[model samples]
Target: MNDEVTRYIDGAAPWQTAVCEKLRLMVHETVPEVEEQLQYGKPHFLQNGDHAAVIAVARNKVSFMVFNATEIPVVKGFVRALGKGDRKCVDIAEGQEVDYAALADILRKTTIAP
Candidate 1:
């Protein structure tokens, strides 16, 4: 785990902090060798030096993004496509539940080769 990324999560709102931690754990579990960093003021997870996922926190919600996930199926909590449709994001607000297992499956299957 990267200290900068940890600080980013620690600085978020309570609810956002929880969501960020969960998302971080999911990425780490899915990709044991994943690298973490703080990029663009958000926490970014990389696999084999390529971006695998990112976690961002805003005022009202936390956003989890999967990279190279254009083929990933749309599921509950997925709010939008990003990065020229090569990425997808799930937004979670306070009290909302996120399918971490599903997101982990997507990460396991996604090829972060770019």
Candidate 2:
């Protein structure tokens, strides 16, 4: 993890920090080849030198943005962000239990090299 990214996450609220860490750990644990870095002032995960995912902390929730995630996964306890694009996000609010296993599966599929 980059120092800047670490600081960015550490500066968030406690609930956001916890959710951010969960997604960060999921990326590293499930896709060891992915690189961690700061992009557009947020922590981004890269795979094959392409943007794979991003961690965005908001006032009410932390967003796990999955790039090229055209197909939504059936992850429990995760709500898809409302938007349009080849991207989608799972908004995790305070006290929400993160389903790491399901998130790992989604990460694997979304980050796979075509």
Top-TM-score structure, candidate number: 1
Off by over 4 Å in 1: 75-79, 112-114
TM-score to true structure, per model: 0.90, 0.86
lDDT scores in order: 0.84, 0.81
Which residue pairs come into collision in candidate 2? none
lDDT of candidate 1 over 27-50, digit per residue (tens) = 888898899999998888888888
Q: Worst lDDT window (10 residues) for model 1?
A: 105-114
Q: What would the TM-score be for candidate 1 when compared with the true structure?
A: 0.90
TM-score of 2: 0.86
Question: Which digits, one per residue and each the tens of the lDDT, describe model 2 over residues 1-114?
Answer: 788889999999987888888789888988898898998989999988898889999899888888777776534556464456467678888888778797787777787844
Worst 10 residues of 2 by lDDT: 73-82
Task: Give candidate 1's error at residue 78 in angstroms.
Answer: 2.6
